[model samples]
Target chain A: MSDGYTESTIEVAGLPIQVLRGGEGPSVLVIHHETGNPGWLEFHNALSGSRDTILPTLPGWDGTERGDWMRSVRDIAAVCSLLLDELGVADVTLVGLGFGGYVAAEMATANQSRLSELVLVNAVGLQPEDGEIRDQFLEAHADYVKSCFADPANFTDLYGEEVSTEQLIAWDANREMTARTAWKPFLYSQTLPHLLRNVTVKTKVIRGTQDTVVPAAVAHQYVSLLGDAQLIELVGGHNLESDAPEALAEAIVA
Target chain B: MHLMYFTEQPMSAYDEHAAEEGVTALLFSNSNFDPVAGSQLYNDRLTEYKLAEEVGVDGIMLNEHHNAPFCMQAKCNIWASVLAGATERVKIVLLGNPLPLADNPIRLAEELAMIDMISGGRLVSGFVRGGGTEQLATGVNPAYNRERFEEAHDLIVEAWTRPGPFRWEGRHYQHRVVNPWALPMQQPHPRIWIPGVLSRETVIWAAKHRYPYIALNTTIEATKRIWQTYDDAANEVGYDPGPENRGYLLRVHVADTTEKAMQNASQFMWMQGEFTGLAHPVWSNPAGYASPRNREALVEVMNGRRPPPRAQSFDNQIENMQIIAGTPDECIRKLRTILEETRPGILALWGNDGRVTHEDSMRCIELLGTEVMPALRDIGAELDLDGPFDSEPPVSISYDEAAKARVASAAAASGD
Candidate 1:
């Protein structure tokens, strides 16, 4: 409940989903990445200053009950849409971060009736024509997290010099959920670019200038494919939300 | 005791430097594979198996791994089929097939059945969850590994035992027609064995199902714990388990001299860390592949809170009996200590791998057959240890005297 947010578990289509809500204005739903929610970050705090920032811990991530029947990203996207409908929120500005961006994009394509704007930060749904999406599962956890940051110190600061066993388990669980959904095509949907053409929301595709995870070409692809989307390159790495929180917050609210 | 021989069938002809550079056996490029050398190694290994049979080893144990040079057998069943044709009297024990990797369990069942028929019912079918890297290579979701493994196992068993054309509606598998024409020659299906290392769940599962649980190269302390778990599970399932339900695999290599044996045995360490790098921790134990408790233990090792078992040096391994190598007499003496401690009904002697020469492997197998195995049989008799053959496997449907008579008469009638 700290950081101007109150946390509660809400049932969405029979599954209990944990959500954090704060601030007051136009609704802004913040979706987390594959490592799961780090909880109430600086960007979250900043975003809550004006807009009503709603952060839901996706099922199988920390604090949320696993949706065992949910097998794909589209299923999760459907769950989120249902969550929004259950929350009774409209014209929601959906801000998806990393893997969350993929889910958000799917949500937009499936049902845009509840959305007003879309912010995809370092998303990984579209396959890059050039360069490859860095495989997080293939690399060691620390190295993978370091690769996500422009400065490794940011990761250290966020996770600390020593990660606890509990944290590692959480990360593993999140990765397991990610693997269950996105392992086959490996973080990118082959038809996501084509699908993005149907996402008619005002979209902002943000990529960190030094992102090693999702290539610049992927960002360009998202922008080119979307009916109303622009690419914003921030001076950070793949984890722009953590490394360049202030700048990322500015872009989200812009 | 039922004594068997095994090797990883390493493709050691590849560049050691390239393998070391890759830092993982799974990711090591196959561009370095030498087909000509691979052919030679394969022939040498097959010859070794034949020699093992001629030398009177009861069985030849084989295992499979994918995308790794450490184990050349991509599918152990394929080798089992070849051995079924190539040799007689030796049980082709697959320890075992990666059940979850098979998209169609019926195909696997049929293949195993063919091997059984070819070998005159000498197939000891085993199932394994497989290494986590296998899941990545085959694109099977790690999260569903256990479910897939259990479902596929059930499906395969049903395919073998039941009059098929039935439907399988399991969570991870769906077979509308569960029919396989090639049923195993063994009545009520071939004997199923389970092999694992430090997986309590697997041990318990094996025990509950009354399958022999083979501990693969685990430390004596770990092996004891595994047996304890198995015994407890067996007790819960209303059975008093005996040594017939237990098996052990040891990296035991014997040669003419102790010095030569030691030298060849050090080759067993070839895949440990020096050359074919150990699987990367993340790749080897992928998310959701292991139980939560096991995953925590692995994380502890990865984070340096606990040292990995691989940290043991070759000399330490030898001292600890994890690796046993000597002249046949010397090996026999050391093996007595292991046999007394574990009292397993089945023992698999992992004879050679890595840079161990074909000549040395042949000599090792010859010596094991001529000296070590006979002595082990004597020790087993003295200790009153009986294998699955001597004492009925708890789970298998018994081939009664009448069934045996029927089979004998059928063989007699088919004879020229």
Candidate 2:
């Protein structure tokens, strides 16, 4: 709560989007995961120390109205690009956590003129060569949340001992939006790997060593596909932003 | 009243323990499915339907589910088509085709029309949004489920009623050549019956369209509330709804004696966690599949604040009259209470499911068709209940008219 970030609603493409801005320097736009934006987190606080952290709640998340017109992840990507244009932020470092990473990669592929660097943390968007991207929809919400963290204790710490009805509803809304974009082809794009060939921006593909959601092969594939990308394995779970915030922040700022 | 026979046609030959170990229905691996057992079960179900027709039930109801061991009918229309050819006198009521799953509604319209023609216009076409898990299995987005369902329903209705060569364009579905050569034999298309458990939106939708809303084994209290909602919606659209606009599906198994009937009725609980718990919670109530209000109610169920209808103990269900199993006379007496309270013009008797043997099912169907159905008809006549066949349902209003009526009603309620 003491992240020094100010939250406001910004109009982009005629849709009201919730944006949280803090710190003072080159801008770093943080796209949230499928769980929606978990408010301004520890990583945002740490990143705000050096970079101007700009976190916008994706459409259909807790803070923003659902954009029924946005049918696919590409549509979301295009919107984020438009957001950057509206913000008029130059040399933006886009940090995407989990599903947000997929959006970041998509944004880069579409237009990278505004983006200086791209960081994808346990992001799911590519078909794995082996194993599979764990289906969050198939499992219980609590079980899926537990699996997202290395130690279930972190989920307890972040979400308290019991998840509130409001939090559950928000998560359901976020999952609905995720299902809208990522239901078919199942959180991965067949042509994304090929599309990454055109993403020439400097990219860091980070994965938690203990992530059970997105397979390790998928993270490696992201690194392999991106022209100027390197893989960074962190000691955490799928939600590195929450599990190892300081480390994830350092990896992005490195 | 129109009496119809129904069953989930459960394939109960699989290892029950394995099903319990995994998710029971959806996502329950098909590796446990034995084709030989499935083949026999399918034929047995067909045989039961034929017997149901022979025994004198007015109609035979069929439904389908995907990737579910609980139901073997992957496509109910296939069975509807088969029955259209095989049966002579029964209305092949589909409770119904999962409209949202069909990428091609025109093709579906053609199939339904063909079945209607083959059956001498005995097809009572119905539509459903399908279960949330079905959306996952079919790779359909649950967010677009309602949209797809409405669009598909409109397209199919248009295909049946309108002349071909019409250009169709909608949000979720589109066709340049909106023409199906095979139109329904029934004038203005076959009667549409909407079946659901507890979705208020579906009830309202059915009411707005003047389709009979069939409550699928809901509690008596819930069914009353459903009728109230339907009646209120009907009033908004400037029509007085009746029993003809309402139907109720109840799990009623009848036999010569109470003991055998009770034992056979218990088979409805043969599936692990019963019918309600057959699906994994997440799969069953996927995000966006339910409205926000309904989703909150489901959360209450998950939190154990409210028990799901099927989660009640078998005896409790019987006590509640949600399930009725007894001798012919006993069933008729109990059903009279249900009929008196719910007052559905169309009654679907869910005869058998789970491990209830085919022989017992046949006998159950026979008992229902003979003693129970005759008594029910008498009771229905005494109660002045008439099905769509007897009395015409109120005409459906256009969406725009319904919307305007809703606003007017809201304003009137607010004393505007």
Candidate 3:
């Protein structure tokens, strides 16, 4: 009884990108956090009722092809532009979660014409001074993982009886994806805040107040600095979009 | 050789009730979530396993997959450890350890052997080269997967059987001072169940050693060919392979009436369609066989192209017989037909895939156990069938007193 989405590995300019899509409405191009998995059905199900959400797993994440052309965040931004053009979705809301928020900011700054609105949740595109993005998910500790959820009871149904090797591999894959995208000496770009000046889209920086990865102060700065942006904090952590879909839905709809 | 499909945690009361039926086996594939969260999920799974054991299920199963948020348990070894600590009677089947992908098979061998010992002797071990997407994530060369599997098997078996301190050498694997403790409680090794379509290597190995081969859910035409291949290979080798050597997997659901069953199964069918809808054409195409040997028999499969098989009606009961959905009588008839024709010693059913509710699945299991199994038992008795299978493959690990001590110390230190 849930909304569902389907995806395909279309060779866009000879590179295999896993594109997720569901519903039939004005297309909303979705970008994933650095630690994204192949199951976009959850997000697609959440957003499919109103508009088709096209979630494309970033290159080098989830076994997608990392074509030579994709060198930096700008390249990803360029690819998002091409993807929007290919799907023929115009004046769309560019939704990004975590690292995806960085991509949304990039698109808003460089390719603002295609984006009608931008939504960033627990985003990481710039450095922080007071606190740091905890590497719990990447580190794969049982305790840190428990803290990520709003309801710990959901862990068993979502994770299974005990952490099987399959679960470990699944988590490892997520870490691997993060490693591929953000494993350099400094995870986020120090120069990204400067890039935020050019983005003039109607932006909403939705964040989890307790999210270790992207804290509130950083989000506040992005909201204050952007030409037209607002910040709304919620009750979950980095993966709060899926955890608190009601709040997220309102943010997107607003 | 009992076959079981360990289900996800029962979402409804009906599924909980169904877990109590004449179900001899249960499988629970852990979802991909964090381990701390998994401990909570594990309780739900453990409840099912403990209930199934209490209801006299012959075996319980676990499997592994990575990074799927929908499922949480990713590591079967860790899962096995937890299950070993909790349950006592039901046989534990890992179904596979994906030998080729594991960076350390020695650790896997030591761990599996320990699990086997800890669970008294009820461990049905299965080895596999794993699937494609997994290979991609593990960075394993799909082309050399078979070779890697073979090599790992040799090393694990060597670690199990050969008495202590020996040098192990192989192309894909190399280990020094090869010593593994905690041999399996089952004489020789616990039973080995090989699951897949008819691969030449698997069939030959299973036949040569008389291990059970569980054919995964495949078309009737394909099953027939696979059976014939096993039969032909056994005959050529001048061996009379027993019925236990043959088993087929089927997705079945039987309700009060054929109409009810169909109605319940429709959502499951839609789930399957929605799940696989985005895959490349090859994955969704039911009619086509991936290998060359079975190309000619491809046309016999009902859903070759336009009409997706999972979404289609139950066609020619004999031709495309794997999808068994109907009233109890209808299901019993299909089960009887398969048992008679294939003469398989085992019939493993998975009536829940793609949104199949717990109620429907439990109903199917209950009907099969209450009505269908008794009928099959009568038929088997009439045929003068032998009792349940007892032949087990040889164990690979054996432990001396010192080695046992080492294992005990290791297990204690690791808090296993």
Best by TM-score: 2
The estimated TM-scores of all candidates read 0.94, 0.94, 0.49
Candidate 3 runs further than 4 Å off:
A1-254, B1-5, B8-44, B67-73, B198-201, B235-238, B256-260, B267-319, B358-371, B384-416
Name the fnat for model 1: 0.65
- Among the numbered candidates, top DockQ falls to 2
lDDT (Cα, tens digit) per residue for candidate 3, span B171-211:
76888878876676765566666666536667666555455
CAPRI quality of model 3: incorrect
Per-residue alpha-carbon lDDT of candidate 1 for residues A55-103, written as tens digits (9 for 90 to 100): 9999888746787888889888999999998889999999999999999
TM-score computed on alpha carbons, candidate 2: 0.94
Clash pairs of candidate 2? none
Judge candidate 2 at residue B261 and give its lDDT. 91
The clash number for model 1 is 0
lDDT of 2 at B267: 82
From the highest DockQ down, the ranking of the candidates is 2, 1, 3
